[model samples]
Target: MDLQKQLNEDMKQAMKNREKQRLVVIRSVKSALQNEQINKGSDLTEEEVLTVLNREMKQRKESLHEFENANRDDLVAKVEAEMDVLHTYLPEQLSDEELQKIVDETIAETGASSKAEMGKVMGAIMPKVKGKADGGQVNRLVLQSLS
Candidate 1:
């Protein structure tokens, strides 16, 4: 099933199971997807849906970090739970070694020689890694390898 339909089905199940936390996170995801559709004036592709999911997951991670820093363990737990739900819908992430291999390949493919070519390497690599790896992590690895 497409993400939208799957989310709807899951939302129904959450309501049936009286899973308040799951329901809340699912509703938030649904709202974000709907808002994107309205803003773009078209339906979202699977890739677009994945992008939205990634953005939501990233936001939750940032919020979790801030909550932890503030010693708000309760809030951190809630956000972490939401993050777990979000991760279920994303593609499997690449391991550090795998990411490094891909970065090396991309750098070679783009003939990138130094940090100055970071953008070129990133542009070449992101499409290959998108939805499978974190962009920030990929960028950092690329810079490290190049430098």
Candidate 2:
């Protein structure tokens, strides 16, 4: 099933199963997708939907970190659960070796020979890595290879 239909089915299942937290996260995801569609005045592609899911997952991870620092186990658990739900919609994550290989190829493709050309390399890499790899790790590996 496409993501929108899959999300709708999951939302219905969550409601019927009385999964309050799961239902809430699914609803928030639907709302974000709807807002994006309306803003752009078109239906979202699978890749576009994945972008929204990744953004939500990233936000929850950041929240989870703050909750951990505050020793709020309750909130931490909730955010983690939300992140778990979000993960179901993202593309399979890239392994470090796989990511490093892609970064190296992009560096060569962009003719980026040093740290000074990091912007060119990054611009070329982000499109390929979007929703599949973490930006920070990508940046770090790019710097390591360049340096």
Candidate 3:
């Protein structure tokens, strides 16, 4: 099933099972997808769905960090729960070593020799790593390799 349909089905199951937290997260995801469709005036491809999922996951991660820093553990826990539900749709992330290898290859492929070429390397690498690795991780790897 497509990601949106699967999410809807999971939302139904969550409601049936009386999983309030899970249902909330699923419904939020569904609402986001629907909003995107309406705004874009088209159906989302699987990759587009993944992009939306990743964006939401990133937002949750940032919120979690902020909440933790503010010592709002209760809010942190809630964001963490939502993050867990969002992550179920993401692809498996690359390990540090694997990410480094790809960075190296991208640098080589793009002939990027210094930090100034960071953009070139990133542009070349992001498509290969998108939905599989976090942007901050990828940027760090690229910087480390380039520097």
Q: Give all candidates' CA lDDT scores.
A: 0.93, 0.93, 0.91
- Estimated TM-score per prediction? 0.97, 0.96, 0.97
Query: In model 3, how large is the Cα lDDT of residue 29?
Result: 83
How many clashes does each candidate structure show, in the order listed? 0, 0, 0
Model 2 C-alpha lDDT versus the unseen true structure:
0.93
lDDT over C-alpha atoms for residue 137 of model 2: 92
TM-score of 3: 0.97
Return the lDDT, model 2, position 89: 81
- Per-residue CA lDDT of model 3 for 1-147, tens digit only, reads 888888988988999999999999988888888899898899999998999899889889999999999999999999999998888888899999999999998888999999998988889999999899999999998998877
Instruction: After superposing candidate 1 on the true structure, give the runs of residues whose Cα lies further than 4 Å from its correct spot.
Output: none
lDDT of 2 by residue, 68-135 (tens): 99999999988988888888888899999999999999998999998999999999999999989999
C-alpha RMSD of each candidate structure in angstroms: 0.8, 1.0, 0.8
TM-score of 1: 0.97
Clashing pairs in 3: none
Looking at model 1, the pairs that clash are none
Q: lDDT-based ranking, best first?
A: 2, 1, 3
